[model samples]
Target: MLSQFKTPLLLLSSLALCACSAVTQLSSTQSDATITIKEGKHSGNPRSETLKTTSFGNYEFKVEQPQGKVLYGVLPLKFNGGYLAADILFFAPAAFFNLREVYPYYEFDTEKGVVRYKNKPQDSWLEYAPLAAESERAKAYFNAKP
Candidate 1:
């Protein structure tokens, strides 16, 4: 009776919690841009990747330039609406934390000859700079291009 329903209810709750996250992929046109993770997995620029996760977390990746410059940065994959709703509705205590921004940003500085993650230009050129309009514009621009 009650005991029999407990296991199923827990399983369902776990599934509901983990299903909050959504997948998104990003890419760049620079041929030299490559990504390498700590696990030694190598990927050719972020092109058509299917990123899926259950928790809001950040992963460190190094972007390599053709000129041999290694740019270390964090690519932030924010929590989708479902994740937020799930946290607020069921995990109210965890909702106290801001899980939206899970990583730092990176920007390239030409004059200093370095890629910076702390200082940013007033006019940033990063493809995904966290602006809704800009992100959509970049997506449209890239999709429109050959």
Candidate 2:
């Protein structure tokens, strides 16, 4: 009876671990394969609650790793769809930075533009400057169906 209980608990823990999203950037070895970032708005519905510019640099991505919650983190998506946050922090998870200006959490997809930040899943931001450049093998990371 005890063994049966242990097995169920272990399985539950494993499932929970897999459910969490991994916030990672490309390393040279795998750079050519993880094309989460790209140039221009080809398909993704990039959005903004307060602003939009003639260029894409003025936008950021609120990437939620887990599906059912408010954004727990922010990701900067620059012009040509290059990931500015990954560029800015160089894949440094926001938890370490403790940046107030960069509101650790955000929900641009909500009915109210601005709300108290919450750690739901994923959130992102954007800014102008010398942002991170797309990796040499950045193109390989896309889900190519075409």
Candidate 3:
């Protein structure tokens, strides 16, 4: 009886793994900001993407405002509690994979001209406080004479 159920269970797990990617929506208050993903595996438009849940890496993104103010940051990803629970209940091996849930909001400090984002999945959103030298570098990058 146990052997009879093994094949079906394997098939189910395979299907679940194949459909593990999550659809994430990226949004910012600056409607004119151009979003560019510098890294990570994702598909779809800049405003939305299907992100791989099992991938472990930083998704570096740059938000360039219409006025040429550019801010760089990483998109946040957290572990999905529901998926974790399911993995634990069904296949213990799947729990070893890094299954992440993407947060839909991207916060920006328009005044400071820095993009704010979480450094880790469980940490609070980071605030950008650039040093004088860093600020100068940013200014130089944006205002360089062509």
Candidate 4:
């Protein structure tokens, strides 16, 4: 009886893996990247808000203070060839969902006094450039009042 269900379960698991679009940029051997407050009163502390990566290669984070002020940012991600190759070889359809695998690096801009996210891909700096805090969602979050 147990064996009767085993094959179906295995098939389902494989299908789910094949459907998984966003392969985490952090490799199985590495730890998940963390986001911390770069400056301000909370500087150097781990941010309590949640950070999530989209299937299209974007990092989104939001922090809301007790006073109702919201601070948020979205960092664009760059494609990783190594992961792309692995995904193609293992999960073909999932490989086409997204090519981006990591967020390279991020820094606190002393001049701008804001955190800047970056990625240095070969030849093209467009995907590697820093992202600004002008996104509509971020704007709304900041403008929202309690």
Best by lDDT: 3
For every model shown, the clashing-pair count is: 0, 10, 0, 1
Tens-place lDDT digits, model 1, residues 8-85: 789868856555333333333445566543222346555333333425344444556678654444454455555567
- Output the number of the TM-score-best candidate: 3
Model 4, span 30-144: residue lDDT tens:
1222332212122222322222222464544334333444445654555556556756765666565556533444443222324444444343323222345444555454356
Q: What are the RMSDs of all candidates, in order?
A: 12.2, 16.5, 7.3, 9.4
Candidate 3: where are CA atoms >4 Å away? 1-19, 38-46, 107-146
What C-alpha lDDT do the candidate models reach, one value each? 0.45, 0.28, 0.58, 0.41
TM-score, ranked from best to worst: 3, 1, 4, 2
lDDT of 2 at 49: 29
Native-to-model Cα distance after best TM-score fit, residue 4 in candidate 2, in Å: 7.2
Candidate 2 clashing pairs, residues 3+ apart or interchain: 33-141, 34-141, 35-141, 39-80, 72-121, 72-122, 73-123, 74-123, 74-124, 75-124
lDDT (tens digit, per residue) of candidate 2 on 1-146:
78878987787566434322222221111111211223223222232122222222222322222333322112332232223343244333522322222222322332222223333335433222222232112222232424
TM-score of each prediction: 0.43, 0.22, 0.54, 0.40
The residue ranges of model 4 lying beyond 4 angstroms of the native Cα positions read 1-54, 62-71, 96-98, 109-114, 117-134, 141-146
Q: Write the per-residue lDDT of candidate 3 for residues 11-59, one digit (tens) a residue.
A: 8877676547655555455776666553334322236666566545555
In the predicted model 4, the residue pairs found to clash are 25-101
